[model samples]
Target: MRRCNQCIVERMDSPVPLIPQLAAHLVAAGGKRLRPLLTLAAAKLCGYPGTAEGGTRHVALAACVEFIHTATLLHDDVVDESQLRRGLASANAVFGNKASVLVGDFLFARAFQLMTADGSLRVLEILSRASATIAEGEVLQMATQNDLGTSVERYLEVIHGKTAALFEAACRVGAVVAERPQLEEDALAAYGTNLGMAFQLVDDALDYAADQAELGKTVGDDFREGKITLPVLTAYAAGKEEERLFWRRVIEENRQDENDLEQALDLIGSTGAIAATLDQASAYADRAARALAVFPDSPLRRLLADVASYTVSRGR
Candidate 1:
């Protein structure tokens, strides 16, 4: 990870002042680096040498994963008009939307450079496809925003594209770099897909249930944006007629106010939406753990399994 972080910075270096400056703003904010970490772990689990000397390809590819993820964050904030990222002002909020979007492009370019430098056709295919799918997922989400009629299956499709697709690629790349068999690659990809799904489900639930400090953004940003997530979907499904009206007003109509967030929280809690979402996330986490059973029972395997559980239990 240390080398991976260095690679991330090294790739971002440009004489252009604002380019590096805007890029560093979000990257320096210190996210979990979870996607890159997944890459490193998957590589090790697949019997690749450590990220030192003989295993440096994984480092570059891991950094490439982070670049892709960071690019998505930059683009996502602009699309969502989000003000906060990791509890700090978002790049779009601080650097303006144009700069943010262009910088996001810069990061995407850097990711491609890393992928090409590695010179693996399969790795290039996996990551590039995931990049396109991420954009599609976000667009899919845009289509579903504020529409209560969006089905659970559609919601899964969105997350699978937007969130889990990269996770799957990150893990698959680990095996690819290690030159693991197709069986090992598939196992790790399955682990990553389930973990990413659980991760996003928990994030959506936390938007209603967690404090600002814990959440790293406004508690009701999704609701304020009229973005329909699993929690709102659950509440909207189970709510009474009047409660449904409130959801329609705040979510569908986009007529939210200060107190509306509090009310939304109450409705979500009353309907057990948060709990239900967490339960669903837990189910995915269990699937993620089971996906790793094909690997030998080692410390890395156990830690990765624990990470799956931790993804759902994040707020508390």
Candidate 2:
């Protein structure tokens, strides 16, 4: 993690001083760095041999993944008009939206630079496509937001593009760098994709279920934004006519009052939406664990499986 941090600092250096400064501020704000960790772990699992110079290309690539993820966060905060991230004021909130957006672009360019430095078209292709897919997902989400007519399949597609695509790329790149067998590479990709899905599912559920402190931002942030997550979809599906009217007014029409969020919570709870969401998350987590079955028993495998389990457990 420290190596990744230093890599970010080194890469952020630019003639435009504010570019680096703004990028550095959010990078310094702590996160679990789970995506990079997965990259490193996948490389290790594949028994990647360092180059003659005693260098692990995986570390640089892992740092690149972090840069991409952080870049998304910076842009996401601006788009969401989010005030807090990782329990601290968001980059857009503290540094202004313009600066945050520019720095985010800078970080994205830096990520591509790292990908090119690695000198693998495969790595470049995966990361580049993931970046594009993430943007598409964001746009798709905006299109679907507050539209109660959104189907479960469409919601899954959004999460797969926005969240799981990067995870799949991150893990797949590790296997590519290590020149792992195709079966093992596919397994790791499956593991990452499922894990990412579980992680996002829990995150969506937490927006309604968790307190502000535990949630890292305000509770009901999604409700306030009129974002339609799975729990909202589930409850809306199960609602009676009066309850459906309430949802249409609040979510579709965006006619929320002060008491609307409380009422939303009550409806969600009554419909068992939180539990249902978590159950879906758990199913994904299990699939992630099963994806590891291709690998032999090892500490890395155990740790990765535990991470999958921890994804849903965090919601609880």
Candidate 3:
């Protein structure tokens, strides 16, 4: 998956040379490739008929998913004004926002080109819908920023659209390419969705609880950005009167101070928000593993299950 990503970025040509450089920056700063791995695992578990011809299509389609994901990261960094991604300077921070946005558009076009080459209308449709959903989720999150009333339910909905939709679509495309039965397709899709949700839950917990260096970004970043996540939601729900007032000032009044961050962290710790969020993440991981029970046992299936477990176990 990583090599395919590198190759695509290397093959890219842009009228603006900076765009290719931005694309290379985005691609080279590696992530787990969890989405593509899910695609491959789904294909294997579905008993894809072994054929040399199918392998190429599978790989191309997987690369297409990663491209779409990378494009989103480029745009997200621009929107979030993020300085760091994958422990390196974000494309927007390094190459400037215009270059990042334009390069992201190039990646989107390249992903479409790859999809067309695969000749799977189903794959195309799933990815297109997922893209739309992801956009809507971003807008929803933007709308809700710093709003103390943002419920846990709403937060879950946002992550489902912003994060899990792509994961689900990736698995769905894998099944489509493999010509899997409907039941198997549904199972893989469910597994991906649950896994993605768990991944995000852990991320939210880490935003408040992790060391700055270990997280590859500043701690309390979400709070500073006024993006309320799971731990904050839990703390808000369970906080004392004074703690609620603290939230009102930091989140509502935009009064973030060092003391405010410490207070928020204290509230999160005292209220058991971090532990609660971890429990939720573990539940989602369990659901993800359970979704694969219908498939015949194999190393690929076991690896998929392990990946789900690892999502929650990851050190931020």
On lDDT, the leading prediction is 1
Predictions: Cα RMSD each = 0.9, 1.4, 1.8
Residue 11, model 1, lDDT: 91
Off by over 4 Å in 3: 10-15, 49-54
Ranking by lDDT: 1, 2, 3
Model 1 error, position 108 (Å): 0.3
Candidate 3 lDDT over residue span 1-316, tens digit each: 5555554655576777787677667557767787776776677677664445446666677777887888888888888888888888888888898988888888889889888887878888998899889888888988889899998899999999889999999888878887978888899899889998999999989988898777876677788888978898899989888889999889878888768888888899999999999899999999999998988888888998999899999733
Model 3 CA lDDT for position 64: 79
lDDT of 1 by residue, 1-316 (tens): 9999988888999999999898678677889999999999999998899845577989999999999999999999998899989998988889899999899999999999999999999999999999999999999999999899999999999999999999999999999989999999999999999999999999999999998888888778898888879999999999999999999998888887779998998899899999999999999999999999889999999999999989988944
lDDT against the true structure, per candidate, is 0.92, 0.90, 0.83
Winning model by TM-score:
1
The global Cα lDDT (0 to 1) of model 2 is 0.90
Give the residue spans of candidate 2 off by over 4 A. 50-53
Model 1: residues with Cα > 4 Å off, grouped in runs: none
